[model samples]
Target: GPGAPAWAYAARRHWAALSPPLTGWMGHADPFAFAPEWQPAPGVRRLLVGTPPILAMTALAAGVASFDGIDIAAAEAKSAALVSVFAALVAARCPGVGVDAPPQPRHGAQLVVRHPHGRRVMAALIECGVIGDFRPPDRMRFGFPALYTRFVDLWDAVDVLAGVIDTGAWQDARFDRLGKVS
Candidate 1:
């Protein structure tokens, strides 16, 4: 009775409930069986390399995340330049959009814009094929990775964003409803 598997099963269930949905893909096994106390279960690879690898590369190139102490001066300069341009545009056109004066660097080359109509603005951008993440009640975030993102792309996105704000297109009732995933 001392070695009963009931305790382990209960612990597993508790962990599963707290973890993300993707954890199910990792399979059921004694996680502590590995030497390091944690390791991916054998033969249970979902996003081991492909997308994560690409995103890692992108983050490194964006000068937001460092790799092996190597500093990317160009990426840093480019990010600053882009942020300056974005801040200027946002300030000039969309007065309601709040842009930080001294932008925080560790945020990974992204602008954290807070607006009254954050969700609606995000929805409008999505409609225009400009994807952005929203923090409910009023915060929209935009990340510009210097890897494949170009100035033209940013300009175009800003143009669409400006149009949305100017036209008050984000006032749509559809944007007020919450979706499965924000």
Candidate 2:
């Protein structure tokens, strides 16, 4: 971390001191301390190339086609798939779960899945033994990561919601009082 900060400082200083030697300013291209004016080579790229490892030293080097460090694209794809699968499952199992994908144009808050009905739906899920959260206005976000969650869990959650909605449990008197934040 210190090294990173020092590198940034040095970069700033290097750019600051890039003027011609006739400007009479020290340009050491270093961050530790400033030095007396030194002329930089004209037409020099001044590029600090990161040292190359080229490839990992493992014997399977030839077949290493992937760079999986922080694979956000893959993560996002998997997340989308999970959400889709869960939403489908909820739709199939609990036909009355009401996704709020109504005829009206969806607000950003709707995209967030936070609505009064969203909270009720979440509470209904919880009452029937499924864990979930509700955002403000109206949103119901569920995470069902592949290689992590089972499809049966989605089914079970839907079943629970269906039961709650069927019983009108979300409309019960116990849920009448809104929370302070609500």
Candidate 3:
């Protein structure tokens, strides 16, 4: 138990439950693993298995994850910048008409936030193609995945969203009433 995490064996063992070595990210171990609390069935094999595409995709992700931190940071900067610009446009065109959810951040260089509004507004954005991620309570998140988002695309995304709110297009009768993962 002494000196047992990557930083030491103890820390590794600590985070092991939440983060697995799925992509070589897990190297921590604890002696209590074989205890009754945890056990792996042996001599069992499933007939349906081996998805090569999944393995290939995972390999691609691991390779990307191994990119230098500086490069990732640069990519993130571009993405956040573009997304922030979009959020600024949304804020500018559709000034908050006053929502009871506490005043939210209007805009910033690296923050692409929007204020809470009715559910129709959210579904409208999704239908427009910007994969908005929904969070609990009332927050919509957008992931401008750096490797592929362009500034023009970002502008267009927000412009369309502005139109949705301006014309009540989001009132289309199909969005789920309940909030989901963002």
Candidate 4:
């Protein structure tokens, strides 16, 4: 969340037609003048709402700076390769689990898989230090960020998943209790 800041972009031609739904003082052309009526600032400045979160902005700047030397194309290629390998592994070793992502180049940096006991399985994986998230009904989502995730991590994760499924480790009652954030 620190790195992922909310933003918007529009073509120069569309600027006049755009209006922020929630107008705040910061979006006024002359906020200090305290005019009787609302006068929006020019361009994207009109989209601003309220005071900026300085600390969050600082964190966002730092997060963005962290990617200064990264080659986005290379990162994307690595992500595709990692996702392909992970999907293949899941298809081969994990019998009951179904790879939910589309074929290579069509999918994103994450891989989703479906299982009957997806929630419990995800919890078990988390316990084993393999962090993943479970969506409602039957999907487990795993993000393979090219900047950090390694190829061996996918192999190890799959191995642990296979073991968990084959041994019925997800049957544990501790995994059934849902937390607020989960």
* Candidate 1's TM-score: 0.59
Task: Residues 48-123, candidate 1: write the lDDT tens digits.
Answer: 2112345555655665443445457887878877777777778787768887445456556788777888888888
Question: What value does the lDDT take at residue 119 in candidate 1?
Answer: 86
Best by lDDT: 4
Task: Give the clash count for each candidate.
Answer: 0, 12, 7, 0
The C-alpha stretches of model 4 lying farther than 4 A from their native spots are 1-5, 10-21
Question: RMSD in angstroms, candidate 4?
Answer: 2.8
Which segments of model 2 are wrong by more than 4 Å?
1-78, 100-116, 177-182
Candidate RMSDs in order: 10.9, 11.5, 9.7, 2.8
TM-score of each: 0.59, 0.45, 0.55, 0.84
Report, for every candidate in turn, its global Cα lDDT versus the true structure: 0.66, 0.51, 0.53, 0.88
lDDT per residue (tens digit) for residues 24-96 in model 4: 7988999899999889999888887677678888888998898999999999999999999999999999999
| Candidate 1 local distance difference test against the native | 0.66
lDDT of 2 by residue, 2-64 (tens): 112111223444664454422222223442344554434332222332232334324235434
**Weakest 10 consecutive residues of candidate 3 by summed lDDT:** 40-49
Per-residue error at 97 for model 1, in Å? Answer: 1.3
How accurate locally is residue 97 in candidate 1, as Cα lDDT from 0 to 100?
A: 86
